[model samples]
Target: MDTTMITIVERLAWTSVQTALLVGLVWAVCRLVPSLGAATRCRLWWLVSLQAVAGLFWAQPLQLAVLPAPALAADTFIAGTDVAYAHAPALPTAQVVSAIHTVSSAAIGAAPWWALVLAALWISGVLAMAWRTAAEWRRTRALLAAAQPCADQTLVEALNLAAEAHGLRRAPRLWMSAQIDAPQVVGPLRPVLLLPAGARALQGDALDLALTHELQHLQRHDLQWGLLPAVAQHLFFFHPLLCLAVREYAQAREEAVDAAVVEGRSERRQDYGRLLLQLGVMPRPHLGVASAAPSTASLKRRLLSLQQRHACPKAVAVALTVAVLAIGVLPMRLVAAPPPPAPPAAPAAPRAPVPPAPPSAPAAPPALAVPPATDLPAAPPAPAAPAAPAKVQEKTTSTTTIMRSSDDDSLSMITHGELDLGKRPDRAYVLLDGNASYAHGAMDDVKQARRDLGADSQAFWFRQGTERYVVRDRTLLLQMQEAYADAARIGTEQAKLGRQQGELGRRTGEQARAVAMVAREEALRAVRHSTDINRDAAAEAARASLEASRAAKDARGNAELATLAQRQASLGAEQAALGQRQSQAHARAAREAEKIMAQALQDGRAQRL
Candidate 1:
């Protein structure tokens, strides 16, 4: 494997482990603090940002491992070392910090162009919402002008009085509607109190009650404040909790509005609840420009406040402040800590100075010395007692092969041998002294390769480490297959004949004679027939068994043939590789031999030229 490829694999492994750990840690923390509020949740989401930074760091080494263009490499080096590091000569602490900030900001802030496009779409949506709100506000004001004025003198008198009391230049547009039972704040710019025609004759306390609810909405500026939830929804659209938080925020605002309404008013509990129920029945409108009747819970909260009739604003404020402070402070204490001090550096080892060797000593020899060509020694003779080659040794060997008949009538060759996948010392690899080569493949490939060699081979079914190895003796395989086929045929034929004789004896009712004479004769004939079948089977199985045996024998040979063919087709590649290695070796040898030659080759080469 190439060094770069190995390095990349290591880096990826390192990153994967780190990423898994980081994710698990963040997930655990999130689960632990499940009840944390929206603001803290927003801060906690910074874990995702932290994870992104970790991913960048993890991928950095992988990026460096890949082949890079010269220009890109130059640019990266200059940017990373000169700009990001910014310590080409001697950088100040602030300069280093600034450089780091610049790089980080550049990376994190680098949004795709499509992000800008999406942002434009978001802005467009906001503008559209604002326009719609404005249009609805204008339409509501215009629609109020078309409503009939209330005939009841008391409601008209209360509306005029409340509008003046709230410092309105224009009179509150008095409208009566059978559709809406309770009074509602119906417009944004000039809010109107819509009263039911049946309730038009309401006086003093009832009229005051209706006007107060509408006035509360106007004073709170609920329409503008309601836009906060809309904005929150737009930005945190991906967060479900944030969306829920927006709803809660709106509820809180509405509750606050209701609290303000009944703060001074007294003896209006049943009346307020009735007003809430009245408008609650009316269908809610789509526009945000109007404030509809409060929800049932909000109405209940309102009713509770009205019925309690207590002056407990200070207590509520104190309680809310304590809750908010506790929410904000606790998580900070848990998650934040000061940076630890740097550890002291270890002591460096001392180096000893050595004096030069005495001048009287002969000069040390060169690291590698190559003898001159003319002074080369003669080749040594071969060993006097040489062992025969592996091929010859195997030629005198005893061999056995076994063959058996399958249910499908196909022949099966069986050869027993040990498997070795480099896990065992004794049987590490099959001997392939001639016409063979060997190479390792993956586990699945090894198994398939072994199975392809035929079911009879024991080596094919065995495993060593994660690979399967085929150990084969071709001669032994062929002979044993022939023997087994004959034996199997004899056994099968005898079993069939014996069964038939037993059946005949059972039918004839002459159990003794049928089982003895006829059955014995049938058994003898079966034996002979078995022998004949065995003989024929052995002959028939020989060719196929030999072929299977040869496949095992030729596995290594076939691999070598493929490798050799591949090498032959790439002659230039081999030549180039060989020449490059040889040239380096030859150069070192020539330099060493130069001193011994003593200008002999220089003059000899000049004379030849």
Candidate 2:
């Protein structure tokens, strides 16, 4: 397998193991401390999840220190030298003696096929989980859009009262939708309480009970808690234990929130429980929304928990929180020490000295009489060569001994030197004294030991004008020291870089949160502005409708008045015609009477005639 793949696999394996251990540990603690509140237990689970994430990025090398061998002589010395060595012993490996050598060799390479397959599998799982979560979230958002504000004034008042009773500064916006079957709370910043259309039929107290439960969810930030586990699950979808832990965490959160909602109103526990049961009969909403009512199984558990009169103690919760934090932080503390330096290689064996050749007949005595007469003061007879410095003869003796200890066998070399000053007292010195040990089982016998020691086994001395001095060689020791110093410097630099990275990460997180807060505020402002615009538009439409109704009524009244006037004119005309006719008839009747009277008169005249 290639190094990169191997390294990745190693890291993944370690991370998985650490995650499993942390989850198991937290789970055990929760089980043992049943009195710990659900909120606290849920937080513990969060800690475990975070610890698993941290383990993925944590890297530390395990190192072993190379210890110096004990000294057999008072001082240390090099072989065949009179100088005493003052420094401590060093590793005898040549490879590690170089200051530039790394503590560990490269062990990772190109990834193997199996590793690639595993990585692909993990990625696929994560993507699948993420896709599922996104789909659910989208569905939930669509459901939210279909919801409308509750129009019932009594229900609105009850919601406000419930919010006040729950000590919430701002009550979540209440919306009712026929699309949903259960009550749920959505949104983190501008929380919305969604209810089914059936909620309109609930009596005031029962409705309040439902509102209070959802409001408690908002007040306690249960949605946010639920999201943390969801994220963990998305990342570790393949890990069944993680999924289980998330499930348990969700249940605990619900139970905790339930307790909080019914804390003071102990007498109404039954009512709240009944409400939950009633809501449970309806279809549960999408997991993306935090439902006030849970599934049937969860509802049963919650109802039973409601029957309990007492809550988890504060002290127990606090203790469990601390313990959980410690457990999460414990895995990070297992850093390894730096590795020890390798031992230096043994020195090569010394060569034997060559003997001096004969003078070869003195080169035939080249013509001595030649320039004898030059007489330029005859070069002032070469000043008698200064008397040769008195020669001091030095003698040195060395002794070797082997010591056996319970754990190892050691070889010791001791050397002593004497300086002989002609016509003066001689000086004696102790040189080259130290011991080297090999683990008892490291080698077979003394023969292997001798082979390992090689030229290092001999003690030698040097002479100058009959003066002798011995020196111990510490080249390997110096190199080991340099290597150790370099390692220390690199470690210090790494620590500084780590601190800088941590600071940068923290600052980045703070900036992101600030930006998010600003964005959230802007979005809320936009929503409020839009809502006001809609409200104003609706009011204007209603006024316009009223004005149009009044105008239509006036037009009808005008038509009625005109009809009455026309009828009066027709009656007046008819009366005038009738009067005219009666006058004509009277005239005719008078004429007739006149005619008759005239006739009668004529007749009377005729009769007179």
Candidate 3:
């Protein structure tokens, strides 16, 4: 029945309520928003993509808002000093508090309108950029130039005729960029097959076969099929596996094309294998706008397919048709969907007076803080109170009064007490409600002892199999209280150390400032000496001119000038003293600051308990 435990339960209840509401709202949006019949109808693929992206962004803010407040409250509760009832309430407070918390959670989830707007904007911007990128690739078709002949012009012509026979539209647009390294296709709507300038001139059947394979990519619009996953990969850059899937998609498209080209042709397995090996000599770019070189894994699969020589296309088509139909309709005919799995049962709440056991209960731990009653010497005799006048008033307060038990005839005692209200014999610390809300380690110890001495003690002990169970039950509560007391002591020491360290810091700072001021004054005096030296040089020059003009200067006047120069020499000594004082003061300040820092560290260690 600790306050921290109560707070934790209350908080968890609120969290569950909020999570349920948010999940329900997301489910509702997925179901209801789809039926709106809006005029701006995007593709089903587009909308599905939008929802999936939006779900990640939308859920992020709700998670941010819900998680922090509850987490902070729970942390505070765990660190608080209060230890008391975790019961329903005396009369109504618990229910009211629970209701308020539930309502507050719902209100917070609904109230963060600005956050929701930001999330929506984020999703919109991402989708918009995706659309723009796709449009940019679409624009590349306009960049196409006139086709040039391959080195084997006759073979190129023959390939063009074969392309026409295969029902391919427009000859593949030939590009000759110095940057291109291998064959590729660029546009989705108006597609092009780009053979590197190097590959286009290569002689032989391998070159012919590679060009034919790339042309097949243009004929079937493989780029269009790849666009969604490409955009998905772009948007979900964080998901490495998704990008891998997109790469696999590109490979699959190429292999599918290869399968089509060799379907019924009278060619040996070595023919295609040679073609794959020749094409893989160069690395391809993953421009996303084009299917460049097929990946190595794709090349391997194509070679293996040639080696295996699967049944021809006509036979494969009939088999695929049967398989697809069976998968599509077989489940509905064979079995109805099983009923939804039952929801998991909620955990039972920790009850009043019957606190939860600690996460890992100690193996046969001793009772906590039930100091042996005999530890104290005999109690002092109670002084007799003089009767007061009727008008004299007194304040009622609770106190524990222990007395020797007359019935026990032993050295046993009982703590029985009541609040000394003017005209009532109301028992102290017991409420009118059935709940026993006042709990403390010392109080629990007394209660356990009293129960062990009572008439029902025998049966209770028989049922639980030990008199020690009563002590064990109350031990957890005692352990918690002792822990709280220790924490309070540590906090007190830390607070005291903090105050002392602050005072020390302030004093050291003042001393440091005084030292800095002295240093500044000494620097100013040093500057004055340089100025005096300059003035003396001018004086000596003036004296030489006066002596030359008079030619009758006396020895008395010269001696007086010498005495004045001696006075200036003494001033220089005073300047040296000032410098020495500044240095000493700075050193003293630094030593004091270091001493204070060490003291602060020691105090901090002590305060940590």
Off by over 4 Å in 3: 1-160, 198-200, 266-268, 281-295, 311-609
Worst 10 residues of 2 by lDDT: 374-383
- Model 3 lDDT per residue over 376-441, tens place: 111112111111213323543322222123234453433222224243221111111111112112
Once superposed on the true structure, which residue ranges of model 2 sit more than 4 Å away at CA? 1-11, 57-109, 164-169, 199-201, 281-295, 329-609
Candidate that beats the other on TM-score, 1 or 2, i.e. the better one: 2
Better candidate number, 2 or 3, judged by TM-score? 2
Looking at model 3, the pairs that clash are: none
Winner by TM-score between candidate 3 and candidate 1: 1
Clashes of 1: 10
Better by lDDT, candidate 2 or 1: 2
Q: Highest lDDT: which candidate?
A: 2
lDDT of 2 at 303: 87
Least accurate 10 contiguous residues by lDDT in model 1: 380-389
Q: How many backbone clashes does candidate 2 have?
A: 24
Residue 148 deviation, candidate 1, in Å? 6.4
Please count the clashing residue pairs in each candidate, in the order shown: 10, 24, 0
